[model samples]
Target chain A: MTSDTALSVVFGDKISDEINDRVNSLADSLKKSGIKGITELCPSYCSLTISYEPDIISVNRLKRKINGILRKEMSVRSEDSVLWEIPVCYGGKYGEDLDDTAKLLGITPQELIKRHSQTVYKIYMLGFLPGFAYLGGMDSSIAAPRLSSPRKRIPAGSVGIGGQQTGIYPMSSPGGWRLIGTTPVDVYNLKREEPILYSAGDYLRFIPVSEEEFESIKLQIESGTYTYKSDEAVRK
Target chain B: MIEILRAGPLMTIQDGGRKGFADKGVSQSGVLDNRSMNIVNILLGNRKDEAVIEMTMAGGDFEFQNETFFALGGADMGAQLNGAECRLYTVYRADKGDKLTMGYAQKGCHGYIGFSGGIDVPVVMGSKSTNIRCGFGGFEGRKLAAGDVVSTGAPVSGITDNSYSPETENTDEIRVLLCAQNYMFTQKGIDDFLSCEYAVSANYDRMGCRLEGTAVEAVNGMDIISDAIAFGAIQISSDGMPIVMLADRQTIGGYAKIGAVISTDIPAFVQHKPGEKIHFRAVTLKEAHKLYRKEQKFLRKLSEKCQKGR
Candidate 1:
């Protein structure tokens, strides 16, 4: 058995699927094993970074311990999930790149919008910035490349798709993702007891909302009374 | 109180560092050169986490509005008290109206000036370190300039000669850890990364230091997705040169990081001014940890010695 101090190691390149499974398993392991020193475990597509106290266990040895458990890792069965319905108003003022993306795909803007919104995407990761979600499972027909030059500043809650991945920018930042729509839902709110609206492994379904509904939801969120609901996950 | 008579580009006040704030998308904005920052604190007989002034490569001039003791460390910036040459990593006394001028840095880019009692600055997110990205901590979230007067809390004593001097083995060659992403590059790329000499580009700051070197290429087929990045991670850009992210590096990145400059070597690497050639050689994570632990031990010893001196 490897010492608790050894650093955990994961194998191979592009181990996204396996990495995600290992992360969920490790969370259970930490709880059941009563492990000490770990303050947090942040899991990504390919790696899980466990932040711990140096005095408890040095990073060098901790990495080895992680690699040890990964050798005989048990498969992580999918857990019950709450499907979050995000209402996004597409095109016109909300989406600046919708028309250009439609032209590139050689399809009408309405067709592009319908194709883009049809699928229920999974939030694979939440990173790059505060509250930013890396959502996967987008239609390839409407897939578009990032802008040659990124916009200097993209507003918060700007829903966009880059290549096959779609995401909602949770903060104002420089982004290359082609903006297709805007969501009034506050993806991140510091004032809220829980700042982030979505977490990794959650499901997100984009439901088209009217401009009037977008305004009403925005005001409700600002006033702090917007209640979010979850639905049954579509079985694989 | 000490007044800035002249301030160079990117000069700011710094303390130990601000850690544990990455979840908020805030980088650990602290003194880029940690060794020198610690040395400055030791010279003044101050605690390890005391606030100190961090000056960049260009140099700056300051005046003691009141008689105070300060110590210089990090770069051999040729600091002078009233036009007299002073030694690096030693405490010196300056009286009121005495102007201290910093000449061009000879070996390093940053120089630290730690006051006797340490500067009294409001701590933001549990640090006095300047965060230039979010514009939050240190001097109204901005760099220092001429005429800015900073006050110290209380006076500390300058004691023995050893307490006023630096005691550690210093080297120029920076050691690093070969990253897991090293396989993304070709064999020649790895060879070039180790053998080829690179100069520090002028496009450098707290965020990262870009190296101007021979093109380091990726393998015929390898593309990397963004992942968790830390301080000292040497990320090779699409243009093929390496950029070592420093205090204010983004929490995550997409660029392939072939290696990370060991934490111990980062102080020296930060001191190398533009046009100075730097070479890279990789070591195991154990070796890297050894180096890091060695520095920490040295720093603790230095602090202990300083405390005993007073």
Candidate 2:
């Protein structure tokens, strides 16, 4: 029990696929249990923090329910992960640090994009801003250092690399992550019924597109004709 | 409709905030001072958690389109109705075209003004509170500007003032509870964090405020796998400086948080302006919950009284 309204259930201290799987599974189980007054069930790297309404359900009763759920064995789920094939334009004005990042890694821009787009990254959580997805799993060679001075504003849909994790900016915000590409898809949209396009426990594969294709997609989005390309990913 | 004659530095309509969207990376953006927000609503006999204009630092002037009863809560801004003295925590009846002018906040940083009915803003993601970072909700997902006309719902027939005066004196002391990653820091680091006084840095905003003072050394380093950030959580960055996470804080973060300020005292903690000093004291959860319940009971009683008066 950390605070009065919220409680943190820690699986482990380190970040790993096993720990994240457990965290997500527990979150789904709790949501399915039809528990009343559970406001937010936030699943992060290795823990799930639950914020509940104290007036609806007392703190002691909420603790007992959580403990009861914890007594059950955690199941690793892999079938429901949605694989979003994102269209990205790499190595240009959209990604200012592409050349510098490749130079630091002693690899060509072609090589960097090859390894980056090849792997299927899993989304462990969403945070830092509206609709910001924390996509885990990246090529070890693609890791880069944070900028000394964070940019005042990074445009939305900018794909950046930070340490071993890579993610899209979701919205324009001040950030220090090294930008390597930009996606044409609107990951976070206010007009849409569901403001956030993606969700945690999903997967993403970056598909590099030409400048012309990026413009076409943007026009399609504006004309209200574009639909996100995604399918349920079968876990490897 | 209320036409804004003069827009101050920052003004927005905030309610109880969006609650269920945190898992999707949406932070709860709401009024910083709920004590004041609720008191204003209760005073107006409006629904609890109704959207109200949150005027920060400097206040603004507006003209009512029709007759309505409005009340001022939270910080005192030397409000005047049609160029006459107006008091906080008291309901005032305004005629059509009556101009309400509010000056700079005399004591605290924010002021809440509640009309008979709540403001007429489309409910987005279960809240009318403005998520300024995301640029949605509130008035066009931005702060109100001069000449902008804002609508209000049908005013309740009459006003009910319980005549409750709230004690809102600013204090430098903030009570906290040790939790989360407090064990990550050294004993000396923890002692320094408690004993030393920290000044509120200028990097203060709706998201969080960075405190400039003695750095709390982390025994296992300051980095942690990003986890859900709570309002009033005191996070220690790599440099060891503490940043108090607030209402508009990101849903999750990677910094190691040593403790969280008690929920009840958050209204008082946010009053300190930049350069003002703040001291931290650790208290038991029992003590924290007692104060929280006390405030909740007070608000509940007001709502009940308002219902009966109506």
Q: Which candidate is the best by lDDT?
A: 2
Identify the leading candidate in terms of DockQ. Answer: 2
The CAPRI classification for model 1 reads as incorrect
**What TM-score does each prediction get for chain A alone?**
0.83, 0.93
Model 1 per-residue lDDT at B189: 93
| Residue A138, model 1: Cα distance from true site in angstroms | 2.4
List the TM values for chain B, per candidate: 0.92, 0.96
Model 1 chain B scores worst on lDDT over the 10 consecutive residues at B158-167
Instruction: Give the per-residue Cα lDDT of candidate 1 at A150.
Output: 95
Measured against the true structure, the TM-scores of the candidates, in listed sequence, are: 0.79, 0.93
TM-score of 1: 0.79
Query: Local error of candidate 2 at B90, Å?
Result: 1.4
The true-versus-predicted C-alpha distance at residue B20 of model 2, in Å, is 1.5
Per-residue lDDT of A69 in model 2: 79
